[model samples]
Target: MNYTAEAPAVWDPAFADADDCLLSSDQCVIHGEHCFVKGLIEIPVIGSDEVFSWGVWVSLSRENFSRAADLWNRPGREDERPYFGWLTTDLPVYSPTTLNLKTNVHTRPVGERPYVELEPTDHPLAVEQRTGITPARVREIAAAVLHPGSGGHR
Candidate 1:
């Protein structure tokens, strides 16, 4: 399941107008009226290397974006890592169907920007990674901090 190549290049201007764009401290870009943001995720596979999925983009409301930004920059927040948010976006290269997933956004020192880790939850993919992951049925959990609802799923 390992990525055959490096991650895809970041598309700077997701929207036509650069003036309305805002990049969060964690590197999520918000632009146009939809508050669009893009990031990547790693999906675990049993008895195999993890798969890296890129071009994972979602659209959030202005208020939700603001809330996420606040949590991203909140002081004394080092104790609380991996902010969670409900972002709906299709995994272009994988599943073309849009998924309403709870994503964990965190920064990894190895990369230039942050990585958005997907919480398996009850998704079918979780079952596939059972043996490859820890403690039988136990799933990797993150703090349920950001609860930005699905503004748009498609």
Candidate 2:
């Protein structure tokens, strides 16, 4: 599915409370002026494909990043682990829609950084639902949507 809309805005404090924010990944990094994290969500489409996994990226504040890192490093505190933050980001391969996703962060290999598992949400990309899509197809769509002419790139 293809869509054209105004570029999605940055994290809006009016719509969310920063104090209650939780990001999905613990491997967030500071790039230039912004902190970024990536995760994946499975979209339930109504066809032979049933579901497809799509990548999602989110922006985080310094405070939230520190909090997530502390929680991530704390030992023997599995039960009280934090849920991924409800912060914001533009969908990597779709229209600049504001997506609120549920995520589970976990440790990867012995030496690698932790990663996140983004769950399904009622976002437009999930609802639009396509079938028989290849990784190449997804990449192409993303390239088109994130191209210079496609609104303002996030």
Candidate 3:
């Protein structure tokens, strides 16, 4: 199960139509300054062999972004060390805001998006990543993401 946000919350929606921005489902760049890449934060689902994932964007330093872009299609890129990044998406279902959270963008082998690992913190999202969540929780997450103001409940 997964939910994907196409662009970071801070992004100006109109900027996508402008030539100054680089916009795609998997990556984004703004005026050559801010750079972001979409990666999966996979959380194991408890009581089952399943995973709940968020396909979210994380901001990377210009150098790291460039390095990632350079090796994006190359094999053996998975060997590179994880890049430190800041979460750029605001997942509103979480109470204390999911934006600006710390993360590590782990490069994968060819043909795969980077695996983003959230820093273990007290935040609910971070805790879920470390501990895992139940299927009921997964359904709630889906409801929250799908029903707007439902707050992940029936």
Candidate 4:
């Protein structure tokens, strides 16, 4: 998924105008929209390693969200399956900016407050180390990446 481009000429405004940055704390996808389950974006497989820097996005559908939440909370569920989480081979490389990893997790047990249990393979810690990105930041970036005509290239 590595897509290289010549260093920008005049700071291509298209990059700025691109519509990424879409996720919110409450809403995954806007109502009545066609959500997607895109691929995970990883960082340099070589070089310095870091942890807890990856994020996950899945087109923001109620169905996928519920499914992921269930798996995180309930590992014993029969429908549980592995999800994808990766690093960006390209981007608007900046901290505190959106552009994140994407994956799914299961819901936590009832009466134990609210939480999700992500599988170890898809763990944010491992993904971040591989990608050198933060989990929360990844989500923010993912929202932007998924935005229409944003040159997301993740």
The best candidate by lDDT is: 3
How well is each residue in 34-132 modelled by candidate 3, as lDDT tens digits?
A: 999999999999999999889899999999999999998888999999999999988777868899999999999988888999999999989899999
lDDT of candidate 4 over 3-88, digit per residue (tens): 22222112234444446422332223332343333222345333335322223333435565556544544545444454332222
Clashing pairs in 2: 22-84, 22-85, 23-84, 23-85
**Which residue runs does candidate 2 get wrong by more than 4 Å?**
1-67, 71-82, 110-113, 122-133, 150-154
The residue-level lDDT of candidate 1 at 72 comes to 55
Candidates 1 and 3 compared: the better one by lDDT is: 3
- Give candidate 2's whole-model lDDT: 0.45
State the displacement of the C-alpha of residue 41, model 2, in Å, after optimal TM-score superposition: 6.1
- Which candidate achieves the best TM-score against the true structure? 3
Tell me the tens digit of each residue's lDDT in model 1 across 98-126: 36566665533432334566566645433
Measured with C-alpha atoms, the lDDT of residue 42 in candidate 3 is: 93
Which ten residues in a row are the worst by lDDT in model 2? 2-11
Model 3 scores worst on lDDT over the 10 consecutive residues at 145-154
Model 2 agreement with the true structure over 63-154: per-residue lDDT tens digits: 65555556655564344443455424555554545555545544333333334444455454534432245555555656766684654322
The C-alpha local distance difference test score for the whole of candidate 1 amounts to 0.43
Model 3: residue 4 alpha-carbon error in angstroms: 0.4
Please tell me which model should have the higher lDDT, number 2 or number 3: 3
Error of 2 at 36 (Å): 7.1
